[model samples]
Target: MTNTTKTILGLIIAILVVWGIYSILQKSSEPMANEPIKIGFIGPLTGDMATYGETEKNTIEIALEEINQSGELKRKLEVIYEDGKCSGKDAVTAAQKLINIDKVHIILGGLCSTETLGVAPLVESNKVILFSSLSSNPSISQAGDYIFRNSPSDSEFGRADAEFIVSQGIKRVAIITENTDYSQGVREIMKNIFQEKNIDIVADEIFNSGTKDFRTYLTKIKSVNPEAIYINPGGSAAVAGLIPKQIGELGIKNVKIFGNFLLGDKEALSVGGQAMEGIIFSDSKDLTQLSGSLIEKYKSKFEKDPAHDALVAARYDSVYIIKDAIKSCGNDDSDCIKNYLYDMPEYSGMIGSYKFDLNGDLLSEEFVIHKKIVDGVPQVIE
Candidate 1:
C-alpha cells in the first residue's frame, strides 16, 4: 500500500476503535436493569427543629434499608438528605440544588409548613414531585399539584381536638399558641370551632416561637379558671419544661391541659414528667400501635427509639408510594411517574390508607386522641 493510503487507513481504524469504546462506556454507564432509585430528602437537619428532621431522616433511612433488602419495590432505593434548617430560603435553595444538581425526580420533605411553602414554588416550577412527612399547614397543599403530604393537615387535627374537648363536657377553654404559622393556623381553627359550638374562650394568648418564659401567659390563662387550656404551640418542648412547674407552683392543678401533636415528643415527657400526666392531645395515628416491631428494630440499630413515632411510618410509606408509582409508570419518565401518582388508589401504608385528593392532599380520616404521662408515654384514650 502507498504510505499516504496506509496512514489514512490506520487513522480510520483508530477512529473506529475509539468510537466502539465510547459506545460501550456509554451503554455501561446507563441505568442498570436493577439500579437503585435516588430520592431527595430535605428537612431541618441542624436547627431548632433538628430533632424532628433527624428523626425523619432516620426513619427514611430505615425504611429505605428495609425496602432495599426485601426487594419489595424490586429496585434498590437511595435517599440523599439535605438540611433545610427549617428556613424558607434554605428550603428553596435545597430544592433547586436537588433538582438542578442531583437531578432527583422525586423530593421528600421540608418538615415544617413554612419551609414547605417556601420550597413548593420551586418544586412546582421544576415539575418535581415534593412530599412532606409532617408539614400540616393547609396552604402547603393549596400551592400546586406538585406538592403532597403524608401528614394530616392541622385543620383535621384541630377539629378533632375541639370535638374531643367538647366531648369531655368542657364548656370553658383558653387558647395559647406560638407565633409560627402552624401554631397560628391550628389556633384559629380551634377558636372558630369553639365559637361555632358556643363554648366560652376565657383567654387567648400568643407566645413568640422561641419564648422560654411562659409563666406570664400561663398565669394569665390560669386566672380565667378555664375548664381546659388548649396549647397549640407544636414545638413547646422548651415551654413544656417550665409550664408544668409554674402551673404547679401557681396552685392550679385543676385546670386541665391540652396540647397539639407537638407535645407528643420525648422532650415533653422528660421535662413535664408527672406534671404532663393526664395532658390530652390529638394525633393522626397511634404511634404505640403503628410503631409495632419497627420501633424495637430501630432502637436496636440506632441505639435510640425512632424520634417522631408514626412519622417514621410516614417516611417508610413515602418510599413504597413512590415505588408503586414507579412500577405503574413502568419507566423512569418524570411525567409518567407524576401521572401514575395522581391515579394511585388508596394505599394501606404504615401510617394509614393514603389516597391523594384533587389538591394533592392525602384523604385519610385516621386520627386518635391520646394523653401523656410522666414518661411522656402516650396512651390512646379514644
Candidate 2:
C-alpha cells in the first residue's frame, strides 16, 4: 500500500477508536434501565411495637410483589429492611446504615413516632426521602421537607377525641399519658383543646413506658372521678391494654374511657379483653371497604389477620406512592421525588383520597370515632 494511503487508514482507525471510547463512557454515565432501585425500610421489628413492623413488612412484601409483577417501572424495586426496635437510637443507626452503606435515597420506615423522630434529622441532613405510615406525632409536621407521613398527626386525633368528649356532655375529663414523644404530643394537644373548649381537665396523670401495673395512676384518676379519661400510651402495647383493665378492676364505672390511636392495637385489645370493651377512640376512616381481598390475602400468606388494617393499607399505599414519585422523577433523585410528593395530586388508594401539604403532611385527613366491641373488633360508631 502507498504511504499516504496507510496514513489515511491510520487516521480513520484512530478516530473510530476514540469515538468508541467516548460512546462507552456515555453509556456508563447513564443509569442501567434494568438495574434494581434500592429502597430502605426502618421499623420496630423486635420490640414492644414489633407487631407494627411485622405487619408493615408483610404489607410491603405484598406491595413489592405486585409492583414487580405489574412492571410499572423501567427498573425493578428492591428494599433493604433495618430494624429500628421502636427507639430513636436504633432508628438512627438503621438510617445510617441504609444511607451510608446501602446508599438508598428513599427510606420508608420508623413505624413508631420515636423511630421516625429519631431518624428525621439524619435523613434530612442527607437529603434522603423518609416516608412513614404509622407515626402521628405533631412535631413530625415540622421535622423536615424530606420527611413525610400519611397518618394524620396526633393533633388531629386529639381534636377529634376532645370534640367527641364535648359532644357527649362530658364536662370533667382526666388524662393519663405515657412519657414518650408520640404520647406527649397527643397529651399536649388534647390538654390545650380541652382548656380552650371550657372542658375541665380533672386529673392529669403521667406514667413511664412499659409500666404494666397502672393501678396507682388509675386510682389517682378515680379519686378525681372525672367523667372521662384519656389514656395515651406509646410503643408499649401492654401499657395501652392493661391501663383500661386496671381502670375496670378499680371499679371506675359510670365513667367514659377515651384513648388515642394506640387503643386500636390488636395486642392491646386482646390483652384488655372485656375491660377494653366500650372504650372509644379516634382513628382514620374505616379502610375495610376495599381491604377485604387484601386482608384475605394477608391471612392466607401469613395465616393471621393484620393488626391494623388501616395502617396496613397505608403502608401498602406508601410503596406505590414512592414508586410513582421515582417513576415521575428519575431514580436516586431525592430532590425530585420530594418535590413530586409535595405537589402530588389527590391520591385515591386503599386509605381513601388525600394529598400532601407543604409540610409533607396530609392536606386533609378524615378522622372518625371507633368503639372496641366483641372479639377485639373496632366498630366505627361514627
Provide the TM-score for each candidate, comma-separated.
0.86, 0.89
Clashes (candidate 1): 1
Q: Determine which window of 10 residues in candidate 2 has minimal summed lDDT.
A: 365-374
For candidate 1, write residues 319-362 as lDDT tens digits.
77887787777755667777777788888877767688877777
Reference-based lDDT, residue 258, model 1: 85
lDDT of 2: 0.87
Residue 21 Cα positional deviation in candidate 1, in Å, after optimal superposition:
23
Show how many residue pairs clash in every candidate, following the order shown.
1, 0
What residue runs in model 1 are displaced by over 4 Å at the alpha carbon? Answer: 1-35, 70-75, 287-291, 372-376
Residue pairs in clash, model 2: none
Q: What lDDT would each prediction earn against the true structure?
A: 0.79, 0.87
